[model samples]
Target chain A: MSDAASAPAVRAAIGDSEFDRDTALVPRGPGVHDIDLSAGWTIMNAVNGGYLLAVIGRALGQTLPHADPFTISAHYLTASRPGPAVVRTETVRTGRTLSTGQASLVQYDDDGTEVERIRVLASYGDLDALPDDVRTTAEPPAMPPLEQCVGAEDGPAPGSVSSPIADRLRLRLDPSTLGWAVGAPSGRGEMRAWFALADGRDADPLSLLLAVDALPPTAFEIGLSGWVPTVEMTVHVRRRPAPGPLRVSITTRNLAGGFLEEDAEVWDSDDRLVAQSRQLARVRLG
Target chain B: MSDAASAPAVRAAIGDSEFDRDTALVPRGPGVHDIDLSAGWTIMNAVNGGYLLAVIGRALGQTLPHADPFTISAHYLTASRPGPAVVRTETVRTGRTLSTGQASLVQYDDDGTEVERIRVLASYGDLDALPDDVRTTAEPPAMPPLEQCVGAEDGPAPGSVSSPIADRLRLRLDPSTLGWAVGAPSGRGEMRAWFALADGRDADPLSLLLAVDALPPTAFEIGLSGWVPTVEMTVHVRRRPAPGPLRVSITTRNLAGGFLEEDAEVWDSDDRLVAQSRQLARVRLG
Candidate 1:
């Protein structure tokens, strides 16, 4: 175990935003850190997968030489709760362009046995150092202005569990896709929203990890009921987001055998594509 | 290492297809196998990323309890060549529905030192056992009749390297996007094709791994020159492909700082979605 004197000083820095403070990690040893899973980030009874990914990203940011995550892939083995957990990171390879590594988030049981919750592999690099050339053939999904959107805090559908993370994360939904919130579903299998942090923290590369998975399950639009548990998710950070709320659009094109796939794209205030993600989940229909 | 008598019998099967023969693995010990990377699958002297992934998939299929890959994410650390290699797989978790594991493909130097080539993590499950319910909102891309399309072996652009894997894999390209082959790019950043094995082998769940990446780089349509090395790729298998050639469509929505993302979707002859993939790559401009 590492002593307090050798701990990473980033955790001790004052005036950090709520997003940073909640995701802060204290170095416990080489390639290991102690994380405190904060409360009020749950969707149902389980901690949101994106929040947990952000926590892991924080640890990797400190452990690797690169400052920004280029790509991240995570597999959810078990549900995580708000409590004390440990993240063990191992360097997989270090190259001139990118550095790769893997990390596991684990919690302990009453019997002192370790229970692994999530396993992640990621590559890190400096996004600002990339070339300045931009060529885009795809445009952002059409969305209403921020003031015209439906607030995430408008309350959950009757009998559905409220997601406390929505308020903390500051999400606004597009009205056309909000039919699922009422008794009428559009059956389009899509969801669009605006994302920002409640604490006014400008979106960056690390926060983009959360933004990718922040939207409601697109399955909801198709009248699918029950918790959609994500089995695996991968996110590619294209560029650092400009300062402002992000425009997010998620769509589900196929749902088979009780399993569905959701694809998401995030555009920054500059309307640049910042990050893209895909996740596979199982629908536990009620 | 275990003696030859304890090796897996699947390698000794008499009537395996060329695809199976090229990807066969002989057990060396528990969770380890020896593989021979065959020649003629190169794209600029480096093995195709999808073909390498299939090699790793064969090992995971034998080690994990589940027989079909549900999701696979691979990071290319170094280019692979045709040679003798070894794959080591380690089980991560085994559940009632899915099993997860990780594998590494490494080649040895003349000095007896091992050089790691690719690192992959995958989850496997039985596709046949999944529920018989499928809901789809997306359709396959429109393509001309097979006779109206251009054959992959028609020849490469004047200065580009010819892909030898096309003939073996039986790929037919959509003529509308073939301007890149004539030095007059369409600048659409998209590629569509029909994929089938030349050996008359019916497409299966495992083969979908290779099918997702069988098309030409979409960047070619936008006039990007030089080798585009894939940094990382993730594929999600949705269903077992129906018998016949598959419809594949790949598109690049954004390209920034010399890095680009290509998204692909594969549909069976019945027009059912079988697999989807997204990859991040660096484009080395000539």
Candidate 2:
């Protein structure tokens, strides 16, 4: 992992280790900290969706004893409880080359009322070891490298917190990111941009997954609209790319009513498919 | 719901109460039940794939409050844990017209060591009470309706438990479902079939949803190989068809190696797209 001033910090708060005492902010743990539903980002009053994805990534990394290179391919579904919840995980099977684990997120009131629950299917194993034919033939579009990709002179306007929780997360758009991206030469239409995260968390598989999901606003083709929090996100991790130089790709599959299902492919500088995610976001135009 | 005479008598030895528990089973609370871990018709130690779908169906039903003219759709993302485990659901949102719920499932040893976990996304609400273009235009296929669809002669061998679970749950099937169904009308391809499930119990929305998932035997295309079960199911409920006479339509989207993904649509005799589902079944063909 490269450490540059522009790199995102990837550790849980110091002494803030109360939630996942058993696991590191990055990975390797029997358990992870229980995020306080009441604290943290407020989107929907449910735990911040970004944080939830981070935890899921951490749990997945820990469970996959051998899954060094993998990416989430698709998200078939999403379910969450409104609350501060604690997530726990169990490894279903761990093979020399393949493994499966399930993670359960439980939302509890201060009274332990058990408000919500979530389960995640984490698949881990060796991808490169698989036959060449199984590998994805789709290559990243050739474009000006990150250095050549320019950032928008004016970044996200000020006071743009559409959701109270998003506001609480202190999310900011960095202008330098525009130059940090390049779309495929094929004119796939989808844009790829790399942005700096506010917290600058290390790009662990989980954090990386979350950060990748947070596509820079510039990726959207249409003009600004209110941001709808993700109801649920399913990410398939294909392989781990270099820590920094996060590559974000965005595309929309089905859009209807006030809801849309979007997909993003996050890559490393090497252009290896790091993770793929599907999100159902409630959209609102400014 | 009416009970057919030929309904499997497997429930007899287990006694009337717990034996017939699959239909009326409710969540112990707001958590997932690792029902697949339990044993029965399929195998001794390995989980019976169909039972997992039944458990999920039951959980989805209880997550929503009682209402008339409601529907649900779900897709199975992965197969279930190999052994006995039951998942319970927690209601995420319970509104007068709409409700959302989440559940987690885990496997455990007889000593209570947890193993696998899964999460579910379910929504229930009353239909607009009026038909719209969104309604299903695909009229119920001309195949013989439910009762007349039975194939005592052409169906699974006299005592072949290998028959698709849908065949067993349904009172009968059209000639299309005779014996074991394989592939679509093109016959060159995917497995497809349609059937009807009786309101063996209350025939409520949840019950119907469970039936919808439990109906399709994606792993059994050629027929149940090992213990293929459902890990997670995502459902979408569009509209309701009349109660009693249930219509089930199934299509396999893709199948490769030992893994397969399927898309299923459930309709009522009236031809309403009651629910839609996708399932991932792990095949361990014997």
Candidate 3:
């Protein structure tokens, strides 16, 4: 615990955090919220799926009595761009231990036509109230120390498209998985990275939503190219992070019929599994 | 390819399949369907989550232009009993490659008040239209030949409750995982089995939904007992299955704070990966 003198400083830092600012929401009505999709969090022009989920999650946290999202599943109907959007939430059920709800992120074009981008179903609960007892048969993926990994700012592999989200995040890739960064692509469908906010803000349960999908597509390692759009994604936030960079490992187990499944796991600084996600995406090969 | 004489028999078998009858829905209106919940498909007393999803999938298939469910995510709100229920479906979007929709399973209580049981979001497409290109880094779990496994009809381990669903389906458990039934758990947090319909009904894409969740909870192998109610489950159907018994494997990787995540994979007779699922469930320990 820090001394009382640093209390205000901590509060001020949280207030200035870029993630907090980007995901901030303005209440419009009973269950409607106004949000802005920040351009800083994009991969090849499309807004990050996890970032979009976090935006919707913020509104959900405000609409329901529960403060944290335990399980969230979103299906991307269309690609979203940086613009003003609205999140409409409806409470499906409010129980003693958990609350379930649905939310939709919609935007309008010049003609004022509404375009729905993503639809989400989620359940919220107080994560702090959970028991500390834990039993896990899975171990965190192997990763090198922060100093030995390659930073995202080092730039994309030679011919790949630059990810703007990389600048907003402190992401370091495991050196061995970077063969795709060069001409020689490793056939292994996996990627491991260390993630944190570039502004040094501690990651919370909300940001873990973004952290789950912030890495490059796992299909990249298997020599498949082009934009791989996510059709559906589900994330389970197991616990709150312990205030440091997160360990993320993603793998594509099967690619067939122009589609692939990527499974991701996020571990906190304490090496506890904080989140897990699986996304189904379309893969186009040249 | 079979001769013409075998065609009618095959058609007749499918028509008589119990799975088809139980999940059959009657069109009540444009988007509403009336269905009957079958008690034969229950674990303890609550209807099986996967079976409920398949019933909803059937409705979604009828409502959407696309026929097969490619991706589906369902949140279980309340336990459902065997009786008359209604499934309401809404089309979200129709795309060239995929179509998205939502569905709700509801029933009335003694007071005639409506109660919703499960809510689902799913995308549908034609599995046969998908390209045949295949690349995989994951392999099916190893299991002994079908004749060597322990049949479900042999009865539940010494003190466990008998599953009615098991009697309706031909399910066999790998011998190594049977320790839990004999009062000693393997502590591996995993279960593998062979699955088929007892009526010799050929498993199709729709029935694949049931096979994904038709197993004893993986937590049972870890010495945890009692009801493990699924809070949410998401399934991705990779492709249609080959006609024969299906291989199913489920594993529990993490259990903390009264919740556990079970990941399941189903392989067809031809050893092709047919479906994959991950479910979050509540676990109560004595």
Best by lDDT: 3
Give the poorly placed runs of model 3, Cα more than 4 Å off. Answer: A1-12, B1-12
List candidate 1 segments past 4 Å from native.
A1-15, A152-160, B1-15, B152-157
- lDDT of the candidates, in the order given: 0.83, 0.45, 0.87
Compose the digit string of candidate 3's lDDT tens values, residues A1-286: 2221111133324446788899998989988899888999987788999999999988898888898899999999988999899999999999999999999999998899999999999999999999997898889999897767787445556886667786678788898788888966689999999887777777898899999898878887898777899999999999988977798999888999999999999999898999999999999867
Candidate 1 vs candidate 3, lDDT winner: 3
Q: DockQ rank, highest first?
A: 3, 1, 2
Candidate 1's docking class is medium
Ranking of all candidate structures by their lDDT, best first: 3, 1, 2
Tens-digit lDDT track of model 3 for B1-286? 2221112233326547789999999999999999889998998888998899999999999999999999999999999999999999999999998999999999999999999999999989999999998897779889987778887545556886777786677788898887888889999889999888777787888898999899889988999988899999999999999987888999989998889999999999888899999999999966
* Candidate 1 TM-score, true structure as reference: 0.93
Candidate number of the best DockQ = 3
Q: TM-score for each prediction? A: 0.93, 0.53, 0.95
Comparing 1 with 2 on lDDT, the higher-scoring candidate is 1
In order, the first chain's TM-score in every candidate is: 0.92, 0.63, 0.94
For candidate 1 chain B, which ten residues in a row score worst on lDDT? B1-10
